[model samples]
Target: MFLRKSFTAALALPALASPALAELPHDWQLGMQPAATPVMVQIEDFHRLLLYIIIGICLFVLALLIWVMVRYNHRANPVPSRTHHNTLLEVAWTLIPVIILVLIAIPSFRLLYFEAAIPKPDVTVEAIGKQWFWTYAFPKDGNFQFDSYMLQDAAAAKAHEPRLLGVDNPLYVPVNKVVEVDTTGADVIHSWSVPAFGVKMDAVPGRINHTWFKATRLGTYYGQCSQLCGANHAYMPIEVKVVTQAEYDAWLAKAKKKYAANETPDALRVAAQ
Candidate 1:
């Protein structure tokens, strides 16, 4: 009976895995986060490609160094060969790096094009970066906007949100839909970034920059201000919740009502507070 119960529990574990959203860096995390979007998957693939190339180059250099130390040491050869230049060796080294650069350039350019080309978006959210917080507006959803502030120690704990990554309001989008985030700085320059989605664009003053991501999974993703803007730059956090289509629609409907634009900035700040 105990073995039977253990087997049943093992079968249920995979179902529970979906609800356990991924978190930020824990102790000694050396790898990139599990990708939640197609762009991130491509980013990881590119990274792996570069990693292989780097490892091969390092190993080749190490082997060459070991060969030199063994073959040309004073104990091994009393007289060193005075060879200043080898034409073939010089050409081979130069041509090999050029070939490697061409190999790396192909996928690098392809990925850049893919990231820059914004598809027909299902939703657009404007992220305005303030001094110490993010203010987001759902222009497509009746211009409903609100400020998102980082929750501190006790506040984050009570809200069940991750430390330094939790915000009072999180940007929401439907899973498998393209979400274009238009970014602009309200004061100084800040960055709107979410690593899981592989989206990051600078929020410049008097200019609108944009990036898009289509979340393939339903969960929460987090990022922080990637630029040093001010004293409380660390306090600015960005959170995104990818949900089902039905849930997204319901949430948008409620958010449209709850966060109307007619309210003054002070009123909105108070409401967010």
Candidate 2:
């Protein structure tokens, strides 16, 4: 209950920032979050196409229902025709659905392949999910890892961080560059997900899963652990800030100093490779 209330307040955090700068979710939002990555753009396109097809199918079905009610009513046709089935109609229904499925499948496969084929990544970040928080490591940057915890309402308001979505240390990456994310869980299974980036990968124990994204826009985006892990699942949120190369370099320098190297030198080297 407390988490739910906090989440509700978190929706208003974007309002505090400039409308043009914030990419966080809005209250009463009816659509998916804005697309900041190439994968998200393709996802939006596929979603739109599906919506159109669904609406057309509903309208066609409605029309058929209306026509049957009008033409076959007791008063309209007193003597019913003894017809069992129309082979042409049956074939048309089957053939049309098959054609529609093919249309949907072609793009679906292409999009999957596009997402799976990660472009030569400019940077890589490893995300490790703990019981109720997230820890991130910039493997190629400086081998420094830091824990990210949800900010309290008071601290978040003071720091200009979104209420529940904000973290003490946000994961940073250069805008317009491909970022490969490695996910793993320390205790239980969890998922690192960001809607705007169209990237979600399960963080399973003893295994590292990979997902990649290239943020085209420079802004702060928030997402939560998608997979239900435990009682504090809702509290584990992800914050990503994409900035220019210069800004990224500055942050990298500061982060390396502030956050001590958590992984061993050999482990870091292996991860960087």
Candidate 3:
């Protein structure tokens, strides 16, 4: 009976993990986060291709070094060959690297095109980077906006949120639908990055940069300012929640009512004055 129960629990472990809506960096995580978007899939493919090419090059160099040491060392050859150079060997080395470079450039161009071409997005969110927090606005969805601040340790503990990553309000978008994020910095320069979406763009003052993603999974994704912005740079965490269309619609309605009244944060207002 005890053996049967252990087997049943083992089978249920995966089931329990599937419903977890959060996807944060885990201890001893290897490689990138599991791709949650089509762009990320392409990014991972490109990464793997590069990794294979790098490994092949390293192995070939190692083998050549070993052959030279074994066949032409002082004890093995006593004297080195007097041949100045071999045209064929030189051409082979140069041409091989060129061919390898061209091969890499092909997929690289495709991936860049994929990232640059924004689809007809169902939702658009504009993120403005402040000193240490993020403010998001849904211009197409009633123009409602809100500030998202990182929760303190006690606050995070009470809310069951991850340290330094939890926010008061997380941007929401529908799964399997394109969402464009327009970012700008209100003060100095900042960056909005999300690894799961394979989207990272600088937010420069007086200029807006945009990136898009279509989340294939329903979960929470987090990122921080990849660029060095200010003193509290590390505290600026971006949180996004991908949900079903119905849930997104519901959140939109509630957000419009809640945030439409006072969209501008008090800090921004003070800075303006």
* lDDT of each candidate versus the true structure: 0.86, 0.88, 0.87
Tell me the tens digit of each residue's lDDT in model 2 across 90-193: 99999999999999999999999999998888998889899999989876677778899999899988887778888888898999999999888889999999
In model 1, which runs have C-alpha deviations exceeding 4 angstroms?
1-19, 262-273
* lDDT (tens digit, per residue) of candidate 3 on 109-223: 9999999999998888888988989889776678678999998889977787788988889888899999988888989889999888898999887777878999999988988
The alpha-carbon lDDT assigned to residue 143 of candidate 3 equals: 64
If ranked by lDDT, best first, what sequence of candidates would result? 2, 3, 1
Q: C-alpha displacement of 233 in model 2, angstroms?
A: 0.5
What is the Cα root-mean-square deviation between model 2 and the actual structure? 7.4
Give residue 181's error in model 1 in angstroms: 0.6
- Flag the better candidate by lDDT, 2 or 3: 2
Q: What TM-score, computed on C-alpha atoms, does each candidate reach?
A: 0.90, 0.90, 0.90
Model 1 lDDT, full chain set: 0.86
For model 2, the superposed segments whose C-alpha errors exceed 4 Å read: 1-19, 264-273
Error of 1 at 220 (Å): 0.7
Lowest summed lDDT window (length 10), candidate 2: 263-272
